[model samples]
Target: MSTFRSHVWSSVGKKMITGLTGLLLVGFVAVHLLGNLTLFIPDRGHAFNAYAYFLEHAVHGWLILAFEAGLLAVFGFHIVAAVTVAWTDKRRARPVGYALVRNAGGKSRKGLPSTSMIVTGLTLAVFVVLHVKMFKFADHPSVVYDGKEMKDLYAVVVAAFKQPLIAGAYVAVMGMLGFHLRHGFWSAFQSLGWNNDRAMGPLQNLARVVSVLFAAGFLALPLYILFFVDPSVSGGHR
Candidate 1:
């Protein structure tokens, strides 16, 4: 048990755990973006509301709660592992502790995304909490869909986006998400021992492409709602 515990806290073990959990989160982000795409359907939230309904009532809601629990666990694991790895790296770089240091490597892979990961990750953590609170738990006008009254999440989304401040903040965080994934997507593979000299370049490029797509996709809804769509009429309710 001591050996196992020591291995889990070791640098390599931390990287492996962080990488795996990061990939899982990447999957979640993709599926979530797909579901959010229903907002663009012109049926005035009918499609989106139905999507929301299915997710909520799936398996009598137990499945969703279970999934949320699992996701939370994964997130907690990823954060702790990543933070510890970063802290260890920082300390190892300057063992004398917080003293002025010069550049140590000309071949360093360090970049904005890699260096700022902790910052962006914690920021996104806060964003996630507020996002869930605003959309999932908050009360909003209800609309009947197929004779079943449901929360007009679409209305809430539209109203929220119409506010410039909220919309801008969302866009900014999504940009941060893009930056995080730009490094995370490929580095996760590298950490998992799947990278080679030949494959690394392509993987990095793919990560950038995916990051841009995700950032743009999320930005579209808010920008569209803020500028083009009328919140008063779009959600099929006031």
Candidate 2:
């Protein structure tokens, strides 16, 4: 047990955990963003709810519970792995404290993203809880579409975003999410030793693109709804 625990606490183990969990989260956010884009269909979330239903009832059906459970586990693991790795890194770097450091090939050390991961990640974690409570756990009014009556999730979102404060918070949080992801996206690959000379540059570039796309894609939704969508149409959240 001691050996196992020691190994798990090793740098290599922590990095592996971080990389794997980060990959899962990356995939999850991508799918989640695609689903969120459906809100723009102008049907008042009809399609969005249908898609949600399909996942919860028709498509994966019972499997959705398992999937969600797995997602929760992954999210939890990522948080732990990230915090542990960040703490470990800090401890190890202390002896070299205040000394200007350089990475391989003489790149600068500890830019904004690397230094801010734990802070940004914790902020994002709080945002996720609030977001889920506002949308998922909160009661959604009944809505009927295509001869099926379902919860009016669209209305809930419309109501929430209608408040300028809420919308503003979302936008800010999204920015933080992007900032955190910027380093995480590429670092995950590097942690896994995928940093070959030929591919590293392109890979890092791709990661940047992915991070920006996610940030912008998520940011666009709230901004569009706040500036363009008429919240009165969806009625009250409850």
Candidate 3:
């Protein structure tokens, strides 16, 4: 049993956890992005907000707690496993860069995608923490508009995009998230034994389509809020 535990902590085991949890996180991102898109519909943001309020405050609070616990477990395992794999690989490769770019024809950049994963994942972690801090922390002063307090979930979102800096930051983070998912989604399927030469073609195409849709859906939110909606317009402040 002790020996088995050691083997479970091996590099391969770490990679497996990272891949699995990373896939789960991808699903979470899709759900979150879809929910966020509700902001585009007039009065729909409140509906979404109410849904969020219910999840947090209702008798089903324990269910929310359980879900959050599971999410945190997945995230923690994913991060630890990713870091272990990366560190192990780094140690194995003494020299960081190779002299000649070795493109063994038909083979993609050997380490680019893997390294990019770490960078993008770290960037997203920082973004998520800051995001929760901005929106989730209720006591944080509301971004005011027209001498009225704009502090509710809907108002905070509207106020957030009103600032060019905040809007651009979200766009930038979403772009990184898109790139991360572009590689991740297909890789997840491949990991789960779906990789077959006969089906690889269609699978790859499907992955691309899903990735694009995910990116577009998320990107549309800030774009619409910033460009189309006017803060001074009616139905904005309630």
Candidate 3: residue pairs that collide: none
Query: Which segments of candidate 3 are over 4 A away from where they belong?
Result: 94-106, 109-114, 140-151, 233-238
Q: What local distance difference test score does each model get?
A: 0.84, 0.78, 0.69
Name the weakest run of 10 consecutive residues (lDDT summed) in model 1: 95-104
lDDT tens per residue, model 2, 70-123 = 999998988997788777767884422211112344454468977888999999
Better of 2 and 3 by lDDT: 2
Could you say which candidate leads in TM-score?
Answer: 1
For candidate 1, write residues 1-238 as lDDT tens digits.
9999997777777888888999999999999999999988888888998898889999999988998999999999999998888888887854211111222222467799988999999999999999889877887788886678888888888888999999999999999999999999988886666766677679989999999999999989899889987765765543
Clashing pairs for predicted structure model 1, backbone only: none
Which is the leading candidate under lDDT? 1
* lDDT comparing candidate 2 with the true structure: 0.78
Better of 2 and 3 by TM-score: 2
Candidate 3, overall lDDT? 0.69
TM-score to true structure, per model:
0.92, 0.89, 0.81
